[model samples]
Target: MAACGLDFGTSNTTLGRWQDGAPRLLRLEGGHVTIPSAIFFAPGREAVIGRAAMSAYVEGVPGRLMRSLKSVLGSSLLEETTPVGRERVRFRDVIGRYLAGVKARAEAEAGKSFDTVVHGRPVHFIDDDPEGDRKAEDALRGIAESIGFRHVSFQYEPIAAALDYEQGIAREELALIADIGGGTSDFSIVRLSPERHSRADRAGDILANDGVRIGGTDFDRMLSLGTVMPLLGLGSPMRRGDLAVPNAYFHDLATWSSINRLYNSKTLREIEETRRDASRPELLGRLHAVVEGERGHSLAMEVEGAKIATSERGGARLDLGWIEGGLAAEIDRDGLVRHTGDLARRIAERIGRCLGQAGVGADAIDALFLTGGSTGLPHVRAALTTCLPQARVAEGDTFGSVGTGLTLEAARRAA
Candidate 1:
């Protein structure tokens, strides 16, 4: 029996364990330490998770593909059910099934079962709602216990990243840890030192923790609305008086967690009704094709890919030929900034709140530590760095730092 650390991120997951005097991320999928947070249920077969889940859906396998399962916590949707083959599965159960699979993989790789664990959680699961935040953590703890972990504890995600960063530092410093993932952006200001790494309690060192629900998914949604939704009649006029196509359908389509809600018959009927009155029936026809074909997830995936491409290469072309012949959109770095700039501002503002909570000036910070997949976005990085011009920037494993730090926590607790 061993204690493991789990990072159930919105975009990806990783499990780590303390070994050989350090925290080591265990391989979860065929030598890959990190796996996409995805699951697919193909008719009568068992659910497949991680990369295989994404691959199965992309390859056109007949199934329900669920991504961003972590986003359901603390929401009414968690108790709601979605059709999974011949069964209606609650979102909570879906999350449990996914975590169970992840646990099984980690155990198999480590050749041992884990009955105790440390889980990483965002600073605020639902920003500004204390009850919702508490509910989310309780729900996650319940899920972890239900999955056979007899003892489970949680660490704030950005704080966990700070712990990992502390392991390599030689001196004490006031550091701001930024963990921007698929579903949320979390920040923490802490006094970290190699000397403090082995301390059993770190309450005094942690100054402030703050976060927002905005993250990579929000960026994807904004980018989609800016670049792709127009072709689907997002802002086009309708035949009716003074009406444009309602933005609700386009928004749901652009959001990863809400995409599936647009795939049912009721939504289809709504699209049809709207299409009948749309001035540009051709655009509505494209929307109809997307809904009727249940291609919302596919479209979101394309948008996400393009966002990544734009971040890395400064631009990317979105091919929507599958939705309609010759349908495509071009998005460049400038356009991405134009659409997602507000989100970046909100994130930066949250950092200011964090600084205030810590009672420290920006220049007083010695270092800025960044982890999480979304931190790779150029504009997002610039926003954080710009806020602290004098602080030196430090980077952690974008997808694994939190889990690795959780492993260290687990080891400490076990000891």
Candidate 2:
């Protein structure tokens, strides 16, 4: 069987296929170069992704389509989404559809059918669990099968990133990979040896990784709480009491930071209550969509739709102009910094604690491999740099790291 690679993450899912003696990213059929990990049910029995579902959401008919179901994987909620016309489907059912869509896209892109794949997940996914390795293996294999792959194996997300970082470690040395992503922050400590790296492709045993379930997405939430909330009057109204409806609305608004859109029937009530107060579901959905999976755009996107001008523009208006007498205050970029500061400190501290636990010192580590959507943040980058001043940090666009590394790994295995 030919091989493919997958990076199924909290914010997005990326694919890598074995082709022409190397791995290539699978280009989706839609105009978009990357397929959104998002899904929504529509009126015609068709599921929407990318721009289509997003557009419909803004138009106020989100249907049964959903996004960010990965976080609720083990919960009973995964098996029970809202009742759509008496048809009940679980979140995994949506995920199963996503896997199938990914497989179809891979087949189209490679122009051939591949039966096997190598996939990556975070290390804490394996490290924190008493059944870490086993859980990782089961989740990876189950996803592959659900998506139509016959055989598959799993590698750690950080480990894959490490392999991508140094495919050939000419010397034996300890290296740390700090992956701060939309879902969680994780790390890996490996004794990279040329001998081991060369042999890792065959047996997949040359990696040792430690991970934590905290990451940059949390920072986004913190910012939304501080700066974004103030703009929406969430801070004061929350303290005024009897603000459950709007408070819940603001709370849901903050949730957009992490990409957790698979809401319960209760969400309908939240919308209804807000509508009674003259809030538009479409506008609310638009705000949610902006912050959903674009972890790289967290702070900037909070000011989208006329509030913020550019990702680096710093200050922009929050466009509360439509809120029918809402405040017309000016929000600037410094607010983002203020909102994101504590989050940055927390991540830095977490990185330090993880390093200390492994008995590894900053000086002894050779390099810091960075990955995930949030890693693109200047603050996060600086945090890693500050925390590991002695180590070299990898540089690249945040979205390309894990899946791109998986592509590199597939070729290494094939060769």
Candidate 3:
């Protein structure tokens, strides 16, 4: 079997295998194309993914839902101590399900079980939270072993992404890969060989790497607060910042798997009473024809949806109709630019610094390879254009490049 490549990312996951001298991306189960980095838990302790999960969530049964499990890979969740459902599910257990899902998709596509898989790991994934990261990596390795894989390996995400772009690059050409992903914004500098055409012949070593735990996800959180929160005045004069207020919103958002964790009987009760006590005028007088109690939560959800869409779609509309009784200010593309611009600039600046430190000038970066779903934002593109004026910024398939490269690395080492 050709080596399987897995770019297991924070916001999206992708799988590819080599066939007929090219990498073939496996299509996911849903008609949907992207390998989304999200999962949802249903009432029966069953898991839904991609479209089905996203749909169940629109119906509003929150709690025990998990999304973006990749970021929490190295966490207490690994121990499975945090109990989900009647059974205990460790961080790896959840991850195993996700991996298994992807594996199944690939298995179906290839008409056979994949016996070898290579994983993409962040350089700091282990050191970031030493004990936990170790456990997380072990957990991932364990998954491959359990599936009867005979060989498995890991490659640094940025380096792997860099190799993906270096192939077919000319000799002595320089390249930089800015893997602005969901949980992190990281860049890698490398010098390339003219003969580079495959991961095996890439003939290069990593120059330098720098990363910050910031990416598109952070921007989403910021918009939730600076833009989406006050609409309901989650914090009144007395409760401002207390009871977690908007911070609670993020706490809820941090995990996309189970939305059920966010509310309890008491919290739900509070929401009910708060809805009555809130004067329509307090929200926006009669100017807003909608935005009642449930609408508030719905509105919050809609904003998140719009933001995700805007990331991919470039611009999305936030329809106030979702808000039932009262409405707050509208969120437009400009609002997104306002809240996320600083972050975009910071990421670009970091990339520039990494290039400088490696003694590779921006002009020498024959191409700036980009990965991660967050790189789709216009401002991020603008920042790169301004900072790397002389280089070609190649946009790799946001979801699959890392995994395919990692898989190629594994295959080369084994060969």
lDDT of 3 by residue, 356-381 (tens): 77876777777777777788888887
Task: Please say which candidate is ahead in TM-score: 1 or 3.
Answer: 1
The TM-score of predicted model 1 comes to 0.99
On TM-score, the candidate that comes out on top is 1
Q: Candidate 2's residue-wise lDDT over 51-160, tens digit each?
A: 56555665657354354545545334555555444476666667777777777777887788878777877665533465644654575478678777776776777766
Q: How do the predictions measure up, each by TM-score? A: 0.99, 0.77, 0.80
Model 1 / residue 371 / CA error / Å? 0.8
Minimum summed lDDT over a 10-residue window in model 1 is located at 255-264
Q: Under the 3 Å rule for N, CA and C atoms, how many clashes does model 3 have? A: 30
Best by lDDT: 1
TM-score-better candidate, 2 vs 3 = 3
Better of 1 and 2 by lDDT: 1
255-291, model 1: which lDDT tens digit per residue? 8888888878898898888889889988999999988
Model 2 residue 12 CA deviation (Å) reads 2.6
Candidate 1 deviant stretches above 4 angstroms = none
TM-score of 3: 0.80
